[model samples]
Target: MFSLRARDAMSASWAVSLLSKSLTGFSFWIVGTGAASAHVKWFCAYDAAGQPRGLENVLCRDFELLLGVALLWFFSGCVVERTSLGELLVRSINRVTEGLRLHTEVMIRAVCGFFFISLWAVGGIILTPELKTTSPQVGLLQLAIAAGLLSRRTMPFSAAGIVVLFGLAVRDYGTFHLADYPIFLGLAAYLALTGLQKDLFGVPPLDVVRYATAVTLMWASVEKWAYPEWSFPLLIEHPGITLGFDNEFYMRAAGMVEFTLAFALAWTPLVRRVAAAMLLGMFISACFEFGWLDVIGHSGIIVVLVAILADDRPREAEYRAPWLAPAGLCAALTVTLFTYYVGHAAMFNTSIL
Candidate 1:
């Protein structure tokens, strides 16, 4: 009987050890994949106009499985939003963030100032790492944008400068490349509208930003499905990131995770706040691996996320119909994928199949 008990204890210990290792590997997978969120174009060779993988190739069994999982996760969150527990979470968060919420706009302005200054300091970079230029004038424009952010009165000018810079980037990089960053346009609109003490018709400027952020992330996630090969080089260089998973599978999982989290940003208050916090953490974690470029490139979005987290506004309407969120997620996935594939085909005159 003593020997039998000893054998059972050994078996239980082995199982626990295995479970611990599995959990550790899963954490590393998430962190490593999140760290790669730094634009792959920065670390890998990519042609914005090149033909992407066909939809048939991208919509594999693995992709479908992940999509189903993401849908379930989103639906679960929505269902939670209607619960008293969600409200309690929201209230707790609001209480903690009350001070921050009041100064959210100020925080954004300060961060934007720092971001533009960093761009000026770096020089030759057009908005992000991949969008490089040798023009000295662009650096000066960045400085000017930073200066404009000094005052609310001149913030509109700063916003206009951001739009101008985005246009320049689009002209140089093409719309397909620029589509990865609709958040810039969203920021510009937010800055301009907020500076002028106005909202987009009836919608708040920050809400416009939320929608744009969702669109940007959803669109970029599709890129992972369409161009997972673009990140192959990075995976080869940093194999540890895969945590022993196949590169293709890892990329598919990353894309699905990003898409689901992005969709959550426009969800009910508790859900969105949690999504914002997770994204912010992911971006920050990436910065540890990619360094200053990652920090500067992602600063704008990071600040926007902070503001989202700090936002304590009531959103009872969102929880009223919890079922709609999963349906919306499905619709959003279809539309974004369709738009990306068809738009790329039209722009590059390439076959999308």
Candidate 2:
């Protein structure tokens, strides 16, 4: 009974609605399936019968906006150089540590011995599910490295032993999972460099410690995002830790905090030191919820973070304006996460969510 113009308008409205529905569905399918590929529960909207149907849930969240902010910050930082600002910031940090010097002899002993005890005590694959298995060989190799460190006569040779263990571990656990313990390699680098009086690239041992700490955090943070559902087991076992937030929101926010702080550790010396302290606190607190395995697994990085506190900024590291460092961090994270989502979505197709 409607006029031609009215019918035409109704048809147009229906078409738009249909297109909206299709796009929304496609987005959800792509994201949910892609996330599932990584064992993550980040993207999914349940249907009326308590079933997941599409991207409606993730679409409602500001996840994309968060990523967008990272990209924008990164590009903007490229426009500003920190020639003066960087020097000033560096000077301020240095002033705080003025006249504070850790005895190199004591530091090398503590750093090296810490690894020996932590690994020998645990005597396993980093105390995580991924590297759950261990062998007597790994323990014996660790002992050799520890002994060499104590004697100083065979320190470089023992350091090489650590590198050999790295090869064995990669063969056992695969590079993807064992990459979490870059601190092992870092410690090896320290032992080797100090044996040669920091001869390799004239890099300081503390620089290796800082870099190892940063890489460890960033690597673990990404795992949290990709396998967020892995934490649900902990949540169900210890419900009080949720702190009244929804599981998904808490996990996502936690990932953001971790990744942000990890990036900070690499970019700014002052901020990196602060971030290390905060992360050490977080890891310690998590022990109550996850127990001793968590402690042992994180032991290497925790020691490295402490080492960072005792040491000053590395001479070789490039200086950047305080703001630019954070901006570049944002960009790195944005690109990393986006690539993961898009790549997996394409690889797995639509059934994954």
Off by over 4 Å in 2: 1-60, 64-108, 111-115, 121-134, 313-318, 338-353
TM-score of each: 0.89, 0.66
The residue-level lDDT of candidate 1 at 252 comes to 81
Clashing pairs in 2: 28-55, 32-353, 33-352, 33-353
Q: Listing every candidate in turn, what is its Cα RMSD in Å to the true structure after a full C-alpha superposition?
A: 6.3, 9.8
What lDDT score belongs to each candidate, Candidate 1 first? 0.83, 0.56
Clashing pairs in model 1, backbone N/Cα/C closer than 3 A: none
Task: Output the lDDT of residue 301, model 1.
Answer: 86
Report lDDT (Cα) of residue 102, candidate 2: 53
Encode model 1's per-residue lDDT on 1-353: one tens digit a residue.
99999999999997885565445434533453565576787777887788888989888766776776677666777788768987788888889888989998898889989998998887789798889989898999899988988888999999999999999999998888899999999999999999999989888999999989988888888888888899998788778777677888778878877888888888778888988877888789778877887888899889998889999877556564777877888988888989999999898898877
Model 1 ranges off by over 4 Å: 1-32
Among all candidates shown, the one with the greatest lDDT: 1
